[model samples]
Target: VASKSNLSLVGGNFTLQDATLSASSGQINLVSVASKGEIIPERGELGVQTPNISNFTKLGHIEMINSRAETTGSPSGGISIRGDQFWMDNSSIHADNLGDTDGKYIDIQTNESIQIQGKYFGVISNSFGKGDAGHIFINTPYLKIDQGTIDTSTKGEGNGGNIDIKATKIDVIEGGIIASDSYSTGNGGDINITATESLSVTDKRIFLTPEQADFTSTIGSASLDKGNGGRTTINTGQLIMDGAAISSNSHVSGDAGEILINADSIDMINGGTMTATVMSQSSGQGGSVTLNVKEKIYITGFRPGLSFTTTDVFENLQSAIVLITFGTGNAGNVNLLAKELVVDNNASIATATTGLGDAGNLTIEVDNLYVNNGGFISNSSGGIIGGKIFPGFGPAGTLKITANNEIVVSGQGAFSASGLLTNTLVSAPGGNIEIQTNKLTLADGGTISADSLGTGDAGTLDIKANTINLTDGGNITTSSAYAAGGNIAVTTSGLLFLRDGQITTSVGTGVGKGGDITIDNPIFIVMDGGKIKAQADAGHGGNINVKSNQFISSPDSLISASSKLGIDGQVRIDSPDMDMAGFLVILPGGFVEASMQNCNTRDGSSFKVSPRQRTVPFENKN
Candidate 1:
């Protein structure tokens, strides 16, 4: 059916198979109704109004198979579809502006569900001339897209259109995609998705084909030219991503877009990635990723408690949530707020720059945080990729973590330890690390470190906690290969205990001076087989300043500040006055009869012995 003016299709159980509906410069409306009342048409027109829609008792289904509905003109026409259940199989709906005018929009409203199943196109709104593309709005109870796509793009001088979806539940699997792209000088469009119940995106695929085995379900936007990438936002009750991705990346001079997610709980496993990155060879600034989760956020490399049909699917995959720049522009920051955040199974949350740009900061605020099984959080600038030096030019970003309760970092991963790190391989200085928690525990090779490998100075590490515990080779350290070493400062209100742990700063193969270590106001400092050192190779050693009430160390523990060729550093310990009541023993309050023997004619004498009101310091044996 082709129309020069407006067209309307209103009935029950409407089905269009191997058909075409085209409007040259007008609108096409499809309304499915199941009722006995009449649907009053517009005066001298063929379409019904909004008030007549309520006369229907119920809505019917709409099925479009191998069909196409499009409008092509300078100012293209619009398309509206309203029904109970809507299904599109090997079908597409398009609105394109062929000239220098803005395109019209496509609206879909379903009372029941909306399903798009195909290996090809689903819905598209594009601009081919100098005009802007139109927006796409979808409202349904449940939405499922398999091996399909919904896109809005601009290949001309105008901007792309936005996409808004509201549903109770959403599932995008088997290489399904929702995207906006800019191929010209205009900016890309934004995408906003709201799911009241749940949202899941699964699989990774190499291509979008019916015979393609892998699934790469993606929701992303990209800038292929001078325009900037579009923003992506998601709001859901629960979010699950398995081998899927959500990304906004730049491929040219345009900047990447931001990503915002709000959920009650989020789970990302099996190479699932959430990233905002400036692509290689591009010159744009990377965007940021912000997550606000009410309950928890869990990220892991491999799927737990699940059997995979193809083990190679996740053989070399690693799940990550990152913001990185591999271009000439600066990277963006990552901010997360949640009740609990867990990173496990070789997963990572990081920000890095492998090019000329500077890396961005990473900030996490949670009630409880756990990084175990080789999971790590880091920010670095310049690195050796593929065994070749990148020599990135700028400084690395800072890392800040604040936990309201406790933080536990334990266990090692396949290649790296479970910890937090900041490093720089270029001439720029490394970033700093700051952590604040009520209680902190680092065990089983867990570490917190900052280092520099080039001429730049290493960054500092500052920690403030109520109590700190480090055992089983856990460490807090800093080092510099050719520059001045970084410092470590720890402040605790309670005891600072270390068993087989270490706190050190050193300079290796460099003429730079070593860094300092400071421990302040601990009730007691106890170290069993632990070491605290500030050493240098050719420069002066660093200093160690400690202030505690009582300091105790095992026979094997050592604290030293020594230089190999230059002058040694100083070690200062200041012990304040403390109450001695807890360590003193008082005399008894009763009197006792005592007997004494004198060498005077073998006679025995007896007397009354009274106790004194005095106390004596007790000695520790162990």
Candidate 2:
């Protein structure tokens, strides 16, 4: 049925089987109205305020199959289907505007559940003229979309309308999409979803044919041309995404949109991704991605306890990735705030720049952070694989991590912000890495480094924690090849222990000087074949200064500042008491020298030791 005025179907149950409904400038309302003493009220007129429903209409499954409902005009009013339960299979419902006016809206409200199935099922609000598209509001207790799409798009000069959905539980599976895209020079619309209980988007067909799972079930926004993309925000109690994505991107010369998520807990596994990126051909700046969780955020690369026989590990990596590049524009930043953040099994949070603009920063604020088993958090430039050289132009951005409780990096996990070396002629300097936590631990070949292999100087390492422990071949270094080495400054309150670990810097054989190492703590111990050296092969050696209450070195642990050909650097230790098991050199409150036999001396080869008390001075020659 087609009508110019409003259409009202007041009944206990409504079922349209292979039927069509259309209203060209008016709304179609399917609701139940109350009657008083057998005096029935007349249906409300178009463009007039209608009486609200006296009570919620209870219907036995209002099903629409193979039906089409559309409203088309200059300023159209859409369809409103309110029932206890709703289902649409192989159907289409649209509210489109053809003239230069804003389109109409579509509202579907149900008290129990709403399900849409079939491959050709769609619910759209589109605009073809120079006006904005209409909005789509869905309110239900449970919503499930299987192989269906809910879209709001515009092809004119006006912006697209927003999509707002609120449900207790939502599941979007099997190539389902809820998108807001703009194809013209207009900004895209926003997508906002709030699930009170839980929200999940996945593809279960991946178990049968793993290659078909390469696609993603997405809820996103996009801009095709010079219009900026719109934002996507999701607030849920718990979110589980497997083989799905929530993103916002720009393809042309427009800025990408932001993606913000707030949840109690989030677990993304099996190649699920959440990103905000600018496409390769666009010159627009990348958008930001912010995630705030109350409990924890777990992101892993592969499926847990799954033994795959395929050779493609790239298809199973869950990525919380963000990018702002492919053109001459700077990339966007990523900020994650949670109580505990765990990124394991090669899951990564990276920000890089391949164009002329600089890379974006990555900041994480958490109570505890665990990055292990090939997990990485880095900000790098010169995007060449296998450490190959490229022509670098832009400078890399910094990485700042702040943890309230503890931070752990183990099992080949790396936290690096190193400058990539271009072809030996020109190179950008490495970005700085600043980490502040209560306790920092690195073990099992874990590394935290900032090196410059190019002509630019390396960035410094500034760490402030309560206690720092590095063992089992873990290292914290800052070095440069042609430029001067970066400095390392550590300030801990309790203890700084290094067992078989290294905290050192070396200068190149050129004119660059080595960087200094300064440590200020209460107790500093380096034992079991640990070395703290600032050696310069041909350049001038750097200084090593330690100010602690008690300094102990045992079992072949060497702390040296020596030069091979240039001047020998100075080693200054100012503590109340010092203990070296093999050799004892005591100097009290005055400058003293401890000589070593068969050592080549340069212009200045002196070891200064100043204690707190005024006691006897003894120099030992070994």
Candidate 3:
């Protein structure tokens, strides 16, 4: 059906299948009423149609399958649907502007629920000319989309329109998408989602086929050309993602947008990812990702047997939350705030740059944090460029973590240990790592390190905690290949314990000096067969300074600052309350003999107690 004017449809139960409805610069209204009500129509100043129902009652169901409703032109018309429940299968609602005028909006409101099911169908608002695209608004109690999409884009000089969704519960699964993009100079539209209860995005494919290798459930915005990507904001009670992706990315010279999420709890499992990235060959700056969760944030790596095959090669990717730049533009930052955070099973939270630009920082603040089984938190820079190694090519990003309660890192993964690290491989300066917590524990080969594998100085590592413990090969280290090693500083208020662990800084090659080690203001320090060394290959060794109230070490424990071909560094220990000789008391190895005389007259009438139960010869004499 084609109309040059307004189109209105009202019924108790409305269904449109395999049909098309077109309106040219006119309004289209579909209202389904379940109860008795009188509909009143009114016209606004611009001859816009508005329907006001007196004694408004309950709404009825509206279904559309393989159908389309669209308006295309300069200053295109709007589409509005009001019903109790709305279902669309293989259908689309589109508002397109082909002229120099701005397009109109698309509004959908349902009292019960809204479900969109299809493989590739969508509700789209687009701009193909110089005009801006239209906005989309959806309001419902529950919203579910299975493989369908709700999106906005701008291919012209004008900006894209925003999308706003408000629902109690939302589920987007099986390659479903909610996105906005800009393919030209215009900026992409923003997306805002607010769910009162929960929000989920998931995919079911465990083994990706060749055709579906790049496909997953997604919610994000992209800039493919000269336009900047759009921001994405999500607010919900609970957020869950499995084998899904949430990103704001750029492929060209446009900067990627930021992502913000607020939830009570968040879970990312089975290769789920949250990223802001600048792809290769792009000069656009990557965007940032911020997650503020009240309860906890849990992330697990890809499940076993989950792999993608390409050209006889199988690749497995871990679950991650990252900000990366592979272009000349700098990468963005990743910030997380939660009560508790757990990254396990090869999962990672990182910020990195593999291009000429610098990497961004990674910051986390939580009550408790656990990184186990090859989980990692890092910020790094430098990678292969033009088929050659670029060591420290750009400045690596820093990492800072603050935990109110405790921070624990333990276990190892396939190639790395669970740890916090900062690395650089180019000629630029490396990044630093700082952590502050009430208690810090590293065990089972866990590590905290800063390394420089190029001709650049290594970064520093600083830690402040109430108590520090390392056991079972847990280590804190800094190293450099051809530059000065990074320094390590640790301050603990309560105690420091190390068992079969190490704290070291070393330079492998060149005349670069080893880094220094400092431990200050600990009540007690104990090292049981632990090692603290700062060694250099060709340069001077680093100094070690330690100040504690009490210090104890095993015979096998080692603390050395040595250089093979250069001057050895100094090691100073200041402990005022440690005196092994003064605090120890020795006992004699002799027996005591006592002679006892008893009053016979008083003992005969009284009760006697025998302490040793021994018989005397005086009894035979009596």
The TM-scores, one per candidate, come to 0.87, 0.81, 0.91
Residue range 192-245, candidate 3, lDDT tens digits: 999999999987666545554535788999899999999999999999988788
In candidate 2, what are the lDDT values of residues 1-622, reduced to their tens digit? Answer: 4545777676666678898888886777665322322213334332333334544333445778898777767765677776778888988888876667777678888778988887747788877777788788898999998888888877777777789999999999876778888788878788899999999987544443444343457788877778777888999999887766777776777777788899999988776677665555767777788889999998776532221211122333444464545456677888989999887766667776655666778888999988777776776665542244444356777888999999888775233321111111137666778889999887876667767677767777788889888888767787777777778888898888888877887766666778788988746555567778887767788899988877777768888887777787899988876335548666588754666355676697689898778787788978
Error of 1 at 166 (Å): 0.3
lDDT of 1 by residue, 1-622 (tens): 4545777788899899999888875788888887766766442221322224657778999999999888767766777888899899999988877667777777888889999989776988887778888888899999999988888877888788898999999999877889888887888889999999999988754333334345368887888788888899999999998888888888789888889999999999887878787767788888789999999999998533222221113334578887777888888899999999999988989988877888999999999999999999998888643346766677899999999999999998988789999998979889999999999999999999999988889999999999999999899999999899999999998989999999999999778899999999898999999999999989999999999988888999999999999888899988865576989999998876555544457568789888886777889989
Q: List candidate 1 segments past 4 Å from native.
A: 1-4, 38-52, 204-215, 303-315, 384-390, 576-622
Better of 2 and 3 by lDDT: 3
lDDT of candidates 1 onward, in order = 0.85, 0.73, 0.87
Query: Candidate 1, which ten residues in sequence have the lowest lDDT sum?
Result: 304-313
User: Model 3, poorest ten-residue lDDT window?
Assistant: 305-314
- Model 3, which residues run further than 4 Å from truth? 1-4, 41-50, 212-214, 303-314, 383-392, 577-579, 589-622
**How much does each candidate deviate from the true structure in C-alpha RMSD?**
8.9, 12.9, 6.8
When sorted by TM-score, best at the front, the candidate numbers are: 3, 1, 2
Query: Which model is ahead, 1 or 3, in terms of TM-score?
Result: 3
Off by over 4 Å in 2: 1-4, 8-17, 31-51, 207-214, 303-314, 384-392, 413-426, 453-456, 479-484, 506-514, 534-542, 560-570, 577-622
